[model samples]
Target: MNNTSTTTLTMKREFNVKPEKVFDAWLNPVTMKKWFFTLEGTNKVAQNDPKVGGSWEIVDHRQGVDYRAIGDYVEINSPEKIVFTFKMPQFSELEDTITVELKELGQGSEMTFTQLIHAENEEQWTDADIVKALDEMRDGTEHGWNLMFMGLKELVETGKVSYQG
Candidate 1:
């Protein structure tokens, strides 16, 4: 039996930076380390090849726990859009597709980020339990992404990266 379920999370943010800069930051290892993964004692290894069929991996090590995110580039349109597959090795049951679209504003940019999360082997979850779990996951994911985006904005605006928590 194959049981799969999906949920999508979407977010939009405006940045006082050019679309190119914002797009490049997502693929740059140095910039990604500063904003994307800011956990203390977490060592990040980011390797990104932004092209169709190319792959990217980011490994964060904290307290002897390694959280690995591996993905492949499905589509890339410079300064405008990117689509990729995302997976966390530690949670093999969860897989997702992420897309980022950038629109040029007056002198800045607006980014729309979307993630479609797919879970396998979810047949065991009751309908009510699944709904609750997804709600909690969405809340937690939003909070985390908001913090990361804050760091990204700081880095792009002030050339400094600081995470409040």
Candidate 2:
């Protein structure tokens, strides 16, 4: 049986950089490692093959466990749009899709990111636990993405990458 309930999260940010630069940061392994897994522990592996049908993977060592995130690119429209299927081994039952659109804004760029997440079974869990898990997931996702964007912005606008998060 599969859970029919889904969650969609959307976020937008404006960067003082060109769309190409912003887009490159997402696919380039060196730049991506600077921001990709900021929420969890250190990233043990980061690799990306930025093309339609190509795959990407990241492994993060958190505490004593290794969490692996794998994804396949579904669409790549240059500096304008990207779509991918994302999966995390820690949440093996759920499969998610992420879509990112970048629009040129004067001399800068604005990016819109949307993620659709299908949650796993919750039958054996209490309502409060489910709610709490959802809340934590939302907050953690938001925080992680924000930090990544900040890292992107800093790298693009100032040519510096800080791993403070």
Q: Judging by TM-score against the true structure, name the best candidate.
A: 1
> What are the clashing pairs of model 2?
none
Model 1 Cα lDDT, one tens digit per residue, 60-95: 887677788889999999989999988887777556
Predicted candidate 2 versus true structure: per-residue lDDT over 34-152, tens digit per residue: 67663323778889889999999888776778878889999999999999998887768467899999999999999999988666646677766666766667677887788887878
Model 1 — which ten-residue stretch has the worst lDDT? 35-44
For residue 22, give model 1's deviation from the true position in Å.
0.5
TM-score, per-candidate, Cα-based: 0.89, 0.85
Q: Cα lDDT of all candidates, in order?
A: 0.81, 0.80
Off by over 4 Å in 1: 38-41, 120-124
Task: Give the CA lDDT, 0 to 100, for residue 147 in model 2.
Answer: 80
Q: What is the Å distance of residue 130 in model 2 from its true position?
A: 6.5
